[model samples]
Target: MIFLMVELMLGVLISVAFISLLERKILSLGQSRKGPNKALFNGIGQPFSDILKLFSKEYFKFSVVSMKFYYFPPLFMIILSFLSCLIFPVVGGFLNMLDELIIYYLCLISVSSYIVIYMGWLSFSKYSLLGSYRGASMIISYEVFLFLLILLMLIYLLSKGQLFNFLTFQSVSGLVLLIYFFYLMFMGVMGLVSELNRSPIDLLEGESELVSGFNTEYLGFMFSLIFMSEYLMVIMGVLFLSGVLVWFSLLGYFVCSLIIVMVVFFRAVYPRIRYDMLMVIFWEIILPFALMFFF
Candidate 1:
């Protein structure tokens, strides 16, 4: 088990590094700008350089009265992010370890809410607090829709006498379910973007408004942990959003990469959605339609 976990950790780290690089490249290509290309081999080694630079920096902590709250969130973010990744493959095999595996994974995914809330509240800065509140509200709202969509997906999968795993989702067969599936995927991807605090919905880290949001005060190695956590969540979100497409096969990876590209595409194309508008979209538009679709 230890060896397996070590292997998984290394694999996940490598994947995250490359995904970050690819995301930068994709964004640059999309926006018609030069991306990371300075470190080594046309910036192929940028991720490694980033890792080294972050490690070389000293960790900084805010002088919060409560030491416990100040330090725990970033560590919590890292731990839960990795756990969420591990739970993916083990979901089908470890039913005894967790009674409701999907719920368990959802908790792991959404636990970042607490971290966000804490970073906002615990920090003395009003910007962090405000950003955290917005982040928390947005995440909680969309998470409900995300959970329901997953349940709906499981039902649809089961109707075909399939297990509730992505491995069971073959290429689309029928038109009706396919349409329904895309609708659900649309909801899922939107929820994922909200969860990761990505563009158009990235109110928490609105640089123009809050000057970097929750982690505004964090610098050096401390900031890297927060940054890395977000990227890890991106990878985790891609796996969750891809769902049945996340198999141990070539097709599965292709599908996963395609979905991830769509995410980056949103970053390139869309402007940030206003906080109030985001709330209306989720509570009014997404939730109502999801309820209707599920029933």
Candidate 2:
């Protein structure tokens, strides 16, 4: 059991590293700039080098910050992010044994929002507080759509006698079903981008305005934990959508890669939207469309 858990953690960590490298490469190409070319194998080693650099730095905390709150939220966030990966159905993997995968996922994500807010508040910085406020608002705005979408999916699946299994969608077939799944995937991508605080949607970490946002005060190993957790959540979100759309196949992996590329592509090409506009996009446009499906 322990070995399996360790294996899962290593796999997630390695994948996170490569995804970071991939994002850098893609962003560089998008901007017509050289990126990470000095590292081993034409920048293949850049992510690991970054990991080392981060861990090697001396740890410090603000005098106003509580040690427990400063340390615990990042660690807890990462652990929850890791646990969410267990919902991915892996062959012979003991960790994916859970039932009602969607419910489990929703619970984890809902909890993570609070952790993000807490982590920010714990930093004792005005920038962090502002970022946390933005983060909470953004999350709350989009999370309702996420919940409704999932509920719609759960209802459709139950109507079809499918008991909330990721693998069950593979056997079901229809134009309506395909269109519905695609809609969910679309909203899932948007929600995940917002939830994970990725580019454009990353108002919580708006560098220009908030100076790294909620994590402004975090550095070194502490920052790395938060960083790793965010990337892991990205992977988990992509995989979840892939499972919904394609199940666990070679094609599913391809789809997952494509989604990751799309995420990086958005980061490369788009500018962050205003927070009010972000709220409008979700509440006015996305939410109504989601409601149409639900009804």
Candidate 3:
């Protein structure tokens, strides 16, 4: 069991890295520019090259930020994102066997956003501070709808006896709740993108506007961790939709690849929304629709 857990996390991490590379490539194509095609073997090794850059680079350990703040920020980010996988039964008809798993997953994923705030607050850079402020407010705005989205799912889950078995979608309830389930899932998907600060919904560190957002002051490996954690949450979103553990390792690869292309296209074509507009869109449009599904 312990071994399986480790493999699961490792697989998730690798999958996320590959997805990041895929996104870069597809977005490059859409923008009519060559993506990362310079690495070993026509950029097949670009992700690894980037990883090496992250591992080999230096981090700022100035006296401005205490060791506690610096260390816990990224650590907690990974911890939170990691725990999200636990709630996902990757295989069909199997239970992850942690009682209160649904509740635990919610708590865990919620903590990831806090870590970003910590990173910015500790960095002592204006851009970092501003990014953190935006991120905090952004999450609060979206989470209102996100929680409603989850509640709707829970309502459906409860209507079906709330069993420990989260897999087994063979239930008639899934069929009965199909419309609501799909609607909630779509909202959840959008919320997941916002939670991870993906493009189209990303406003915190708008590259053109805020200059790398929260981690502008971070060097090498620190940003690497942040970057990985972002993709980690993206994968977590896909895992949340798994609904069964049967796919196990295979499903992780397939869905992540598909999402990479989708997000890449989304980024290539869409302009980032104004911050106020982003908030209003979520609350006015997504939230009410999600609530309607619930009630």
TM-score of each: 0.88, 0.91, 0.86
Per-residue lDDT for 62-131 in model 2, tens only? 7887898789988998999888867655434553545565677888988998888998888889998999
Error of 3 at 23 (Å): 0.7
Which prediction has the highest lDDT against the true structure?
2
Write down the TM-score for model 1: 0.88
How many Å off is the CA of 195 in candidate 3?
A: 0.6
Instruction: For candidate 3, write residues 175-275 as lDDT tens digits.
Output: 33334466665566677678878889877788888798888877677677778888887776655554443254564456545555555666888889899
Clashes within 3 Å, all models in order:
3, 0, 7
Off by over 4 Å in 1: 59-61, 90-99, 161-180, 243-247
Q: List the residue pairs that clash in candidate 3.
A: 89-245, 90-245, 91-245, 91-246, 92-245, 92-246, 205-213
| Model 2 whole-model lDDT (C-alpha atoms) | 0.80
Provide the lDDT at 120 for model 2.
86
Clashing pairs in 2: none
Ranking by lDDT: 2, 1, 3
Q: Which candidate is the best by TM-score?
A: 2
Candidate 1 lDDT at 219 equals 69
1-295: candidate 1 lDDT, tens digit per residue: 6566667677888888998899899889987999999988899999999888887887555565476767778888888877776655534443324436567777787778878888878778989988988876777688888888767766776787865543343233122233656776767778888888888788999999999899887766667778888888888777655544455567558767877888888998899988889989999999998898756
Model 1, residue 64: displacement in angstroms? 4.0
